[model samples]
Target chain A: MDKQEEQFVKAYAPATVANVCCGFDVLGFALDAPGDEVWARKKETPGILISAVTGVEGLSADPTLNVIGVVAQKMLTDLNLEHGLELQLHKGMPVGSGLGSSAASSAAAAFAVNALLGNPFTTQELVVYAMEGERLASGSAHADNVAPSLLGGFVLVRGYDPLDVIPLGVPLDLYASVLYPQIELKTSLSRSILKQEIPLKKGIKQWGNLAGLMAGLLMKDYGLIRRSLHDEIFEPERSVLIPLFKQVKDAALKAGALGCGISGSGPSIFALSPSAEVAHDIKNAMEKVYAGSGIETKSYVSKVPEQGVRLVEQSIYQTV
Target chain B: MDKQEEQFVKAYAPATVANVCCGFDVLGFALDAPGDEVWARKKETPGILISAVTGVEGLSADPTLNVIGVVAQKMLTDLNLEHGLELQLHKGMPVGSGLGSSAASSAAAAFAVNALLGNPFTTQELVVYAMEGERLASGSAHADNVAPSLLGGFVLVRGYDPLDVIPLGVPLDLYASVLYPQIELKTSLSRSILKQEIPLKKGIKQWGNLAGLMAGLLMKDYGLIRRSLHDEIFEPERSVLIPLFKQVKDAALKAGALGCGISGSGPSIFALSPSAEVAHDIKNAMEKVYAGSGIETKSYVSKVPEQGVRLVEQSIYQTV
Candidate 1:
């Protein structure tokens, strides 16, 4: 083994907001804070191992059961690297929070291991390996979350058959506010409630909004973004499951938010604003909706980050 | 009456290609040639009249039956102008060729009359008035054609309730080639064959492509535009109605066209290319498919113009 093999690399992957209102299953962006961290070390052995997991309870340490371990194993197998990997996952975000918790861990682990091996694959090339973790967690291999968590900025999952994930231009002044209710909403149950068939007229309107939102982001038109960030397909059906969804959305909009909608398959809600001050105000307004209602909530205000799955720390250690 | 009322104001409105593959009923762009012209004059009396109709047989000269007359009458009524108007309609493109023939007439009349009345409305304000002519012709008030024909460049009809028409950026090097097969396909028949409900999976894919195409246009990414110019919902059902649709599309792509699809309703195929030379090549290749098949065809190759309707000529004359 090389001298670099004895070093431990810790990487941080940002939490992502998938679906992004009008762009269901197609758009996502990374947040600046509240991300997962993974520490990776390569060994002379030939099997993947999860040394520990922290920051969240009830997570398994088994290499086959953990998301980070599974993603790292896939990367190693795909690259034909016979070296063993040891990982420690620190979850900074709650699971089932609609904040792409699993995607963050997978991206951090894959990025850390790639860094340890001198990055044989580009950051864009690591999206597929990270998607396997989403499939294990949500029973579907979707890149909306994984792509943004790995690539940062705004991402468009243009297609899935050939797996085309495109990184889009991000408006630098845009900010996001997320309010997560401390309740679990199963991704499968949320998905099952959606109608399999939609009216053609509604579908046309949805795509129009998608096109408008994409154009608004590219041109940095705030009014167009506010007008286009609406969901007519998935939000109506899924919002019934979220407590006080309408009230939260209304409060966010009243607090100077550009747009607001359910975050992923939610119990969580997200609102976008033009500035960090407005985003903080939106977060406060959203939190007020759940106040005195016996529901605990966690809120985050952040600027959309430009980088994802970055190496945070690295240290050399002596083997016992 | 004023001295300007005695002069003849002639305006030209360009033909448009609607649907634009993935963006059905929402996207369109203006072409440079094969447009209609309208000559308008205000008299001291208070009723609208169509003085002459030329360049196409079987068009009505009656104010109520002619599209230009109807559009001009509506505009006068809406603006509360109590002046008599005389219009001369000159059709430069074939009717029912899926080249937005009626939309051109409506836009030209609206634009000409607006100019004659001291330019009371902006170009964007004329789209709704132009869409009224579409309703009279096609039984549906769709602005996909008239919006682009009035606003120039590419337009997205984001919504219909309040009528939101947004103009998109067009690449300077983009060229379009259109081949209109001389066949009449009724708009109602073309619309009736479409299914009312579609699978949600197909809808997701369609929106993904729509977002990608909009991004491609705003960023001037030719490869992304080529990849995203696909129609999963409309073209499949509509292409079967057009003769040699598959053969023409295949030939265009093989001849270095970026994308090819049915224009407006049917019988007209449009291809976009990076340069005017490649667009001309695509036009030739598409024309060869129907050369010996006994189908008469009209082909046009032009760069996408930045201006739509404009005053082509003005002449002063005495009231006889």
Candidate 2:
């Protein structure tokens, strides 16, 4: 461990949505605004250490299950860099709320560690590392959330072979209203319930929408994105688990959201709008829907944070 | 019908493949070196009239069953064009051979009539008209083949709402080897045999390929297009109808073809190559594969024709 260093590091990892309804395990983008923050300090020690943790409750009996712990260890191992670290993870977002809580933690850890190592990895490379941590939490190495969390904008995974990621333009006038109902749907269980096979016709529709969605992102055409946001395969079954899913979605649309749909594997829903004015109305509508169903919900009205994970503050200490 | 006219005006139609394998229906291009030619001339009569027919045998059974005849009538009705004319269609490409014979016929007739009427419509407008003709043949409205036929070049249907069609850069060095076995697979029947459902995992794979394919076309990257021309949904099931399908595909790959697969439907296959040398080798390999299987076949080696359908040559009809 480098005992002489004394700089505190803080970072942010934004929210993301996977699948986009029709493009399950394939398509995703960074939500405009709202993210988790993490701060850490380097310490002198003989062995790797996560001396502290917060904003995390009942995470896992095994340290390996903790996203930050796992990601921190992997980054160290991948770089062959040894360091004892005192970590403070601000779990600013709810756990398992389908807003990429796990991804946020992994991203925050990756960002801090990359900075600690002198930022040796590129943003996409960090995403690849973060996805490894996410896989420990969800049992799949999906980059949809991690890519956006690290890149801080609309990220497209063109193909995996030599992974091509496209960062697209976004309309500045819009803010997304994201809501999390009290209803809980475990990410692992939600994914397990899905059918292994889907209709060929459904696949066709999904591709068309996905293509249109990519185009919409590139052009920053809000209407095109909204009209193209369809989830023909995964949402039908997953939505049943979220109480009043249709009510919330319909209400969001009525409230002037360009479009609305479940975020990740929900209990959470997100609505797209041109401004906070529209986002505020959508939020109220969503709250009303949740209220009608006798469920408490939490919501955030914000824009997509274009700056991905970064070091906010850092410090170092030595014990000889 | 044109008793007072010196020469009888006639029209022809071409065959087309709508989906074009990987793209389903949204994307398609034209095959121009060979196509059906439609002829149209003024007549004393005030409506369309049919005269001598070539290539297509026994198409006179019903005017509705004849895709060309139906499209011509629809165009006339839609535009409310009132003129005396006779139509003649020369079927050059074999039907159900996966060479887009239907689209060729439809586009030929539409172009001839429009030319005879002084070109009132743009290329895109003609594509929509040709699609109506394809509907008569395949029971679906698709514009891929029609668009390329009317407007020659590779195209991207960015979206259908505004009907955006962006032309892509064509790779000059790319050549194709097409082999048609003396067998038939009706497009409708081919459409029917497909499984209606597709798995989400596979959907991701398809989109990856789609993106790669688009990038390859845009960048004029032959290697990329070859590596990405994977048709996950249609090729496997349809390839069964082509003799020695596996062997032919293997030989083509071994002989320097980047990638090879079933073209349009069955009984025909195509390979992508970077040069004429590789293309000719693929042709010889395909012949070897089919000859051993006791199937008579014809082959054509050509580049992506930069031009679609046009009036190749016309003998001027003097006023009687």
Candidate 3:
């Protein structure tokens, strides 16, 4: 496709919290309407190439070293497709901030490149490609965030091969509030502070919450979600690193959030509420707690992202 | 009521395994048509007391120290039902040999006692009472095996407070093979070896499997269930004690079992198969491995206990 017909494939992928409280790396849902954007065009050249970056002042446009670049290249390499990508990342979400900002960029780029390459890979194969982005971030391959980002809604990664992804019918009433502090807690560091061997007792506690969370997502049972949101392993260890973790979480509960916890690896907190009314209230409470700590924060009161990364406009000369 | 007019309650409680590999103590399920038996009758003395033990050797009829006795007292105390009881516990299963020997006995006594007391608590509450019994043995409130034994079928313990229990709709094609290898991995000793904290990377993998298992149960999707039946956290650590763990698991997989793992703590292993045909194959393979290990093993091929603890003959009574 030439520049005249060169429509920009601008796709918006949500910022996901990979370890959603009880679920750790295997569970994640997309943020509704609040994600980052990646705009790509098929180049006449034959390899993936990052052309521009914005909002992330520290990032480089080098295609090989960038997280977004690596994901796009892996997808093309695996699919045996030969096409260069001119990717422009509009960093709407933060970097190394634990909202899965990098994954959003990666998902967007992989999704766009695949689209530009005529979309040969299946949705799950795209997820595998997106996981390369996660491997780059933390040196471990995880699908919790990437799977949901690629498939949309709530996805259970049953297995990698034959790729069993079960779609949970999300409750229509769910509203979420995610508060991001100005400080960044790199995924690498947040993960490092965690202990290597969890007590068997704590392991059971975490999975109990995991099973309940899965049920809650399927049944949209808010009460069960609140009861199941307890994370005995990561939160106890990682929360100590996040300022005012207790106060913010208590605020969320007091503000009527069904439950609240540090999102992913901290510096960001998330609350689950049954209504938009409660979601906003929970957001305000988190804001108040962060304010007391002399930290500015960005918060979102949204729903689970239903449509994952999608072309904002046909780029038939477009935007989303 | 005289002996001729006595109200006798008899109940069958299936064997259960707590922790269930990845789930630890928070997840468990009951095996059908094979377990233990409890027979209870109201005492004429107006106080709770145990009177007999028929099967498990070394078990006593004491009302305090006996596993079944303590659990029975707790159940009656909650009901404020002061009635001495004549309890006969028929231990069809082995003691201290995994397969939830202690849990089955406790659940049966509590369940029988509950029936004797007019059934005041819900099934979940009975599990709570049974968990109290486990505390006597392990010194903590754990529910891996007790929940499923009391509630029957597959159980996902979401939380302890208000105890979120989700009953999984198991696949109709599912058949379970419980192999007892004439050995015992004491819950206490097995538990003591676990690390105090787990690595962040591995924790997420466990949660992924947990969610996948739940989804598999709900969807009755066998392939998903097999793929999801993984224990990244506990099994890796605990399986070290169970000799031939990997080879046995591999053989079962090769024999067409959906998934196989260490049942309860150790010395026993269970495999899920699609049919009795596959189950027989699993039995042969498992027996071949453990039999060669210089360890004698027993196996039970069954299905999920469809109806949990229940009255077999409510109004009728027959004893030879």
lDDT of each: 0.90, 0.71, 0.76
Note the DockQ of each predicted structure. 0.85, 0.38, 0.50
Looking at candidate 3 chain B, the ten consecutive residues that score lowest on lDDT are B311-320
In candidate 1, stretches whose alpha carbon ends up further than 4 angstroms from where it belongs are A1-5, A316-320, B1-5, B316-320
Candidates ranked by lDDT: 1, 3, 2
lDDT of 1 by residue, B1-320 (tens): 66666688999999999989998999999998899999998987898888989999999999888888888988889889888899999999999988899999999999998888878999899998888889888888899999989988899988886677889847557899999988778888899999999898888888888888887898788998898899998899998998899999999999999899999987799999999889999999999998998889999997888888899987765555
Q: In order, how many clashes per candidate?
A: 0, 55, 16
Instruction: Give the TM-score of each candidate.
Output: 0.97, 0.85, 0.88
Q: How should the candidates be ordered by DockQ, best one leading?
A: 1, 3, 2
| lDDT of model 3, residue B311 | 61
- Give residue A43's lDDT in candidate 1 (0 to 100): 81
Window of ten residues with lowest summed lDDT in model 3 chain A: A311-320
Residue A260 C-alpha lDDT in model 1: 92
DockQ of 1: 0.85
Query: Candidate 1, TM-score vs. the true structure?
Result: 0.97
Which candidate do you rate higher for TM-score, 1 or 3? 1
Which scores higher on DockQ, 2 or 3? Answer: 3
